[model samples]
Target: MNIRKVLTAVLPVALLCLAATARAATIGVILPESYPSADQAKELQLGMTLALKTWPGDAAPKLVIKDSGCDARKADAISQEFIKAKVDVVLGNWCEINAGADALRAAGIPFISSNAERVKAQDLQLQMGRIELNAGEKIAADLRRQTGLRISARTSCWMDFDAALSERVDAVLCPVLTMDRGRWDQVANTYGAAFRKPFTASSARGYAAMEVALNYLRRAKAMKPAAALKETQATATLLGPVPAADAPAPTTALQLVFAPHLPKLNAQQTQTLDKLVKTKGCACPGGTLRNGCPRDSGPWGELPFVVRGGGTPAACAKAINILEL
Candidate 1:
């Protein structure tokens, strides 16, 4: 499918009118193969439904969900089918989804982008001139507020992967993104999301599957691609860090990281940290390491086999610092 074609297919026209006499609009939603995760998908679906419930007007947009399977080729075919079906709009739900939306656009249809990854944003806006996001920018701002910290390109599920934590020790804070694998699943289940009216989360915020299609379709009613993009940028709002209360806080938790290539520590401070490491695994104070300790040895090691899954560190939930060892 070409760009213009799919966009027009996906974005519903106002044909489903403000009149009760008119029919509803068809909004086709394309998503990642395993997107939003299983639980996340359901919650997102619920969130979209909730938004539609309060949408201002006499008509509601109908949702048709399908898994794109992360295949670019498949996405192209899907986009074409939606266009053939005369869909009002089609929204691509993952950051790396193919350029079929451009095909839809070229075909004179409006496409809604649901990608939130940095690479995706850069490629979309730079290449297609059709781009939107959810939390990518806000996360950057949040990262800037953090001083003396840098992120690891390494994608391991390390405890300190979030660039936000290097600023402090003792009492630590973590981003839920770290909970994607391992025992993190149970931990992440606690949080949820909701949106305000005008429903920026679906449209102006991150690219909402439905809103992207709708907004573009509505605007296409008047402007060209360049004008539509200008309008989108002018209007999009920050999506995540939702309401502080809506998303769950990282549970009272602590993790350790080595203070790499640092100045030598004083005797007394070093001694105190070393003491904690010996007695309490490695929860040393002031983010320093405990003296004479081996790596990856936490209090949970006492188990005959294992305990505190994922190799719990030696420090208490409220850790003091990394071990000098």
Candidate 2:
């Protein structure tokens, strides 16, 4: 071969090798440190680390974490910082994502979160949470069957329950994590041991978000900054595939869905229902309600629920019982 020709071929091959070897990308993570989600932030970091370890690759994404404090002002400021740094992709805001979402989108950076309710899904805003298809009707049916059923909407632990009920008339829906209590406890215990705090709903979600982000980067080939800004409408994650679409947010406030008539509940049963509401949440095999409410007895017998606005709690409970039937 001529010397000039040989040089051309060798140079191209060497450049290709160099590009392949230096394929690392940067990922920015913003967590609410000032407020309660500090622990969740730590757990999120842990989850990302675990995902990276599990998914072997030479071109690992570098995580650049920043604190998007609980306040909107702080979140906005942190977002500005991420923009200045020109991070490839952004993940964060365990709290009000509105603080940072607008700025990030304007800058064309991808922002992913487990807390879907905070920000409406938009151009570059992505949520890692899932939606329930038909929760309200089902709940009403169950309540009706068990007349005199004492039920209360306990939303303290359920994340997306209110959102689910939106499809129903005169009410919002909430979700109860019916996943296997045993497995969840085991996982929470492990996380607590590692992080020195009990694992929480936020933590599990943070972990799931990281896994989802990793999945997107891997599938989308966002190893370069330009590629990172390439917004994805939907991506598969550890929890499930999520799309950048408007999702329901969690609401502690409730709306009563009135039935034609109320199911009669004796005072004693009403008291039992009150007790169930005192501790809101559902206990099932898997942290999910794929099947109906797990059959049980006493305070736990019927599924725990909540009603709001219009009608008394006792009245609403009776109405729900009538609806369930």
lDDT of 2: 0.53
Supply candidate 1's per-residue lDDT for 78: 78
In the order shown, what is each candidate's alpha-carbon RMSD? 15.1, 10.7
lDDT of each: 0.40, 0.53
Model 2 misses residue 127 by how many Å? 1.5
Q: Tens digit of lDDT per residue, candidate 1, span 1-325? A: 6999876876565444434335566777665536334434444455456545545544677777776655677778778878787766666634344446666765555565544222243211212112222232333233223322232212221111232334332222222221114322221232232432232122222233333445554554466755664455433212321111112222212222323322345565454434333433432233334553344443322211111112134442123333442
Could you tell me the TM-score of candidate 2? 0.54
Candidates in order, TM-scores: namely 0.43, 0.54
